[model samples]
Target: MKSVLAHPISQEMDSVAFEDVIVTFTWEERPLQGPSWRNPHKDVIQQILRNLSYIENQWRDQHIENQYKKILSDI
Candidate 1:
């Protein structure tokens, strides 16, 4: 008997000017006690990166709008 598990981690950064952002993705490998166990860490990491990119874009758009609103309000 064996167990299979994979852990994926991701991070996103927003630019100070609210014009750009970056995303980082990584994974952690655990002990695999089964012969049939396959490491899907890479695929998981790729998917996480894709999702993070999408989220980052959305965040940048919202941030820009918010900044514009703030500037208008201040004026």
Candidate 2:
């Protein structure tokens, strides 16, 4: 499905000077924290873990794709 951002500040530089930026954002109206993140329930903790794993896999895939493109361009 197609997706869109909820905020306009897409890049760090988009903010004005010395603006507090939200590094971790969500499309939902509220952040996904159902309870205390430090002592969250099992389900909340699992969601956090899943998000972390997804981010890691995305980073790995992007890194590999960039390397592949660089190699192809250099050839």
Candidate 3:
């Protein structure tokens, strides 16, 4: 399959502000206790935001290709 990072939508993601990204992530009703058995906590969500910050830094540095490579490799 083609890489999502290479998609046109990713270009729009690159333009979005960091604050907007955080707002988007936190806006939804994320249940503390899930439909699944595991209970998720605020810190888990916060950690995701932290990881996103790292990716955002790379995106801001215009290392788009390298970002894709890193993401794909992680998967």
Candidate 4:
């Protein structure tokens, strides 16, 4: 629902809605290489949408951990 990006070097973060994230996704099956457990052409966007909640949670956890470490280092 908020900024889903988490990077140590980025000082400014961009905010985006969950719906916006879903709406703005664009991809191509072509020009893709390597192997996978499933077909790469089958609804890649939908699969990512399904897993977005888990991905968001991981980002939130990582962001919190980073903030905590920053505070500890500042002390």
Task: Give the top-scoring candidate (TM-score).
Answer: 2
For each candidate in the order shown, give its overall lDDT on alpha carbons: 0.70, 0.75, 0.68, 0.72
Superior by lDDT: candidate 1 or candidate 3: 1
lDDT for each residue of candidate 2 in 1-75, tens digit (9 for 90 to 100): 998779876456653553464244466934676556635556766997999999999999999999999999999
> Which window of ten consecutive residues has the lowest lDDT sum in model 2?
15-24
**Candidate number that wins on TM-score, 1 or 2:** 2
How well does candidate 2 score on lDDT at residue 63? 100
The model with the greater lDDT, 2 or 4, is: 2
Give the worst 10-residue stretch by lDDT in candidate 1: 24-33
Arranged by lDDT with the best first, the candidates are: 2, 4, 1, 3
| Candidate 3: tens digits of C-alpha lDDT, residues 1-75 | 875655455434345765775533343555543756333556677888999999999787778777888999999
- Over 4 Å off, model 4: 1-47
| RMSD for each of the candidates | 12.7, 11.2, 14.2, 14.3
- Candidate 2 residues lying further than 4 Å off, grouped into runs, are 1-40
Model 1: per-residue Cα lDDT over 1-75, one tens digit each: 896558544466544842444343344343433334434655766998999999999999999999999999999
Per model, how many backbone clashes are there?
Answer: 0, 0, 0, 0
Which of 1 and 4 is the better model by lDDT?
4
